[model samples]
Target: MNAVNDDPNGDGPHHDGPHHDDLRYVYAVCRPLAAPLAADLTGVGGVPPRQLTHAGLVALVGPVPERDFAEEPLRAHLEDLDWLSETARAHQRVIDALTSVTCPLPLRLATVFRDDSGVRAMLEDGAERFHRVLERIDGRVEWGVKVHMESEESAAPRAPADAPRPSGPGSGRDYLRRRRSQRTAQEESWQRAEAFARELHETLSQRADDSRLHAPQNTELSRAPGRNVLNAAYLVTRADSEEFVELVDRTKDEDQGTSRLRVELTGPWAAYSFTGDEKDRAE
Candidate 1:
C-alpha cells in the first residue's frame, strides 16, 4: 500500500524558516472545499491548521516541529493509549466540522502527507478513484445504528428453586455452575438482540444507498455513553434521511425487546464512514 509519509523532510517542499517545524498534514477524502474545517483544529503537534486542495477534494493540514513527530517519538507515541485517544478525538473534531457542511471521506488515524505537493500528487494520481467515490456519495450521508444487550441480571429470567441444580462438590462448584448458566443466558439474549438488529438494518437498507457492518468495539467503548450494539452505518440519500429516522423510530416501537436489548440511531454525518479513496477501497 502507498502510505502517506510523516517525515517532514522526506519529499515535500523544504522549509528552513522558523515555522518550518510547525507543519503536519491531516487527511480527508473527496470533500468539497466549502466544507468547514474545525475552528480549533491543529496539526499533529498543535501546528496551526491550513487547507490543501486538489481536484475537488480538500485536506486540513498544519506545520509541526519535525522533532515532535519524529519517527522514534511517533513509534512510542503510537503505543501510548492516551496519546492515541487524544489524537483520535482531535481527528474526529475535524471530521465533525467538515461533516456538517459536506460529504467527506474520513481517513483513519495517522494518515499524514509531507506537504501540499504530496497531497496534490495523491489526488492527481488517484483522481479517477476519487471521482468514483464522490459519485457514489455525492448526495449521501452516513447514519449509525447500534444494538446492545443490557446486563444479564436485568434481562435473564429468574430460575425457580425447583430448577435442577448441578450436584457439585462445594459452593465453588455451585458458583461455577451459576456463572456458566448466566453466560449461556447472556449469549441467547445477544443472539435475539442481534436478530432484531439485522431485521431493522434490512428494513432501513431498503431505503439506503448503501450499508455496511462495522467491527465491534470492546465494552470499554460503552464508557462513551451510548447503546451501540450492532455498530452498523448506512449511506442514505440526503432527501430521505428524515424519512429514514421516522422508519427507524417505527421499527424500534414494533421490535421492542426484553428490557435487555436496546437500539439507537445516530448521525446524518458526512459520509465519513462510507466514502473513501476508491483506489484504496471501493467503499
Candidate 2:
C-alpha cells in the first residue's frame, strides 16, 4: 500500500516536517492489498486517510493535530467526555472502513505515532502478532447482546385484605418501610437478572467463535431501560450471522410474557472485541 494523502486541495500533512501541529493517528493494520479504500474515507480530525507499508503489513492512518493528540494533551482531552466521544467515533470510522474490505487489526482509540516512519516501525515490530489476529478474524464480524431488566409494572395482583399494606403516601414510618422493601426488591431483581444474563451468554457462546463480556454500561451512558445485566460481544463467521440473529430473535420472543428481561441484539460490527487482549473472556 502506497501512502498518499486523499485530500485534493493540497492541504494535508507533509510526510516530513516539525510543524508541531501534525501527527499520524493510526486506526488499524492489515496485510497489504491491491485495492484502495473509498475515495472519501476520512479519519480523526476529518483528515484524509492514507496508508503506510512495511514488510507484509500496512497501517491505515490519518493526520491529527499534535496539540490535540500529543500524550499530555490527549490525556486531558480524554477527561472531557464530548472530546473523547467525538475522537473515538472518528477513530472507529477509519477502522470500520478498513474492515469492510480487509481483516484489520484495530489499534486502540487515540493511538498516534510521531510520523509515518513511526507507524512503519511499529508495524514491523508487531508484524507476527498482527498476522495472527488478522487470520483469526478474517471472515468474521462482531455482534453485541445486551439484556436489560425492564422496570416491573405496578399491576401485580393485590395481596389479601388481611395482609399488611406496604405503606401509605408520605408518613415517616411508611417512608422507611417502603425504602426497605424497595431495596429488597431491587436486590432480588438484580440476582434474577444475573442468572438470566448468564444463561443467555452461555447459549450464544456455543454459537460464536469468540466471546467477550464487557462491563455493564451505566444508565446515563447506555440510555437503556431498567438495569443492564449483560453486555456481551460475540464473534461469528459471516456465513453464520443470519443464524445468530435468528437465535436472538427467538430468545426475545420467549421472554415476551414470562419475564421482564429484554434482549437487544446489535451488530455486524468490525471484530472490535475479538481483536484485543484487553477484553475479558466470558466465563
Candidate 3:
C-alpha cells in the first residue's frame, strides 16, 4: 500500500515542521482511482486536502499540524462557534464534491487517524466491509426531508386571552397549569405533524433502499421560523430520485391544512448518513 504522509511544511492552517506528523486526519472514503482528487472543488478549507488510495478505496484528508490540533487548542477551538461552523462547512463542501461524483462513506466529525499509513491500513483491513457499504449505496443519493409546523403567530390560534394575571398566592400553581396546558396543545400538534411526516417517510422509504431520521439540530430550529417536527434523510436510487421528489411535492399538495405544516425536501446528495463500516445483520 502506498502511504502519502502530510507535508510538514505544507501550506496548511497549521504549518510548522519538516518531519511528518502522525496526527493526519481522514475525512471521507470513496472508490479508489474513481474518486476525484482534491483539486476538483473550489472553496474547500484547510489548505488543499488530498486523497490517499488503498486497494479499491481512497481516503480524503488534510494535514492537521501537531500544534493547532493539540488536545488543548483543539478542545478550546471546538467550543468556538465560528471555528466549528467554518470547519463543518468545509467538511460538507468536501463531502458534496465526492458525493457528486460517487458514493462516499462520510466519517463522523473529528475522525482523525494517526497518519496516512494508518488511513491506508484501515482501508485495506476494512476492504470487504467498505465494498459492501459501497455496494449498498452505489448509484444512490441522500435526500433530506423535514416537516415543520408554521409559527404559532402565523397560524393564529382560535383561543385568545387578553393577558395572564396572577390570581393569588397560588400564582405558581396557576403558572404551572397554564404552561402544562400550552405544552399539551403543542405536543398534540407535534404528534399530528410527526404522524404525517412518518407516513410520508414510509411511502418514500418503501421505494428507497434505506432511510434514517437524524436528530434535529438546534440550528434548524433557530433558523427555521417554524417548529421542526421531523428531520430525516432517505437513501434513494438515482433512477428513483426524481420520482421521489415528485411524490413529496404531490403529498404536500394533498395534505393542505389550516395549520399546514410544511414538508421541505432537498438534495440528490451522497448517502453520508446511511452507510457505515459496521453492519447490522438485522438491517
* Candidate 3: tens digits of C-alpha lDDT, residues 1-283: 4644332212233333223763656668777544333443432245556667778677877766666566777798889989888878878887777777778888876677766677888888888888889888988999998888876556766655776566889999989998898778767777777788788778888978888888865745469768777788988999898888999889778754545688888897778677763455446
lDDT of 2 by residue, 114-185 (tens): 887788789778777787788898889999999988765432466788997555556778788877987787
Residue 280, model 3: lDDT of 51
Question: Which residue segments of model 1 deviate by more than 4 Å?
Answer: 1-18, 35-48, 154-188, 220-229, 254-259, 276-283
The positional error of residue 95 in candidate 2, measured at the CA in angstroms, is 1.7
- Descending-TM-score candidate ranking: 2, 3, 1
True-vs-predicted CA distance for residue 223, candidate 1, Å: 4.2
Answer with 2 or 3, whichever has the higher lDDT: 2
**Candidate 1, run of 10 with poorest lDDT:** 1-10
TM-score for candidate 2, please give it: 0.78
Worst 10 residues of 3 by lDDT: 7-16
lDDT of 2 at 125: 82
**Between which residue pairs do clashes occur in model 2?**
none
Q: Rate the local accuracy (lDDT) of all candidates.
A: 0.66, 0.77, 0.72
Name the TM-score of candidate 3.
0.76
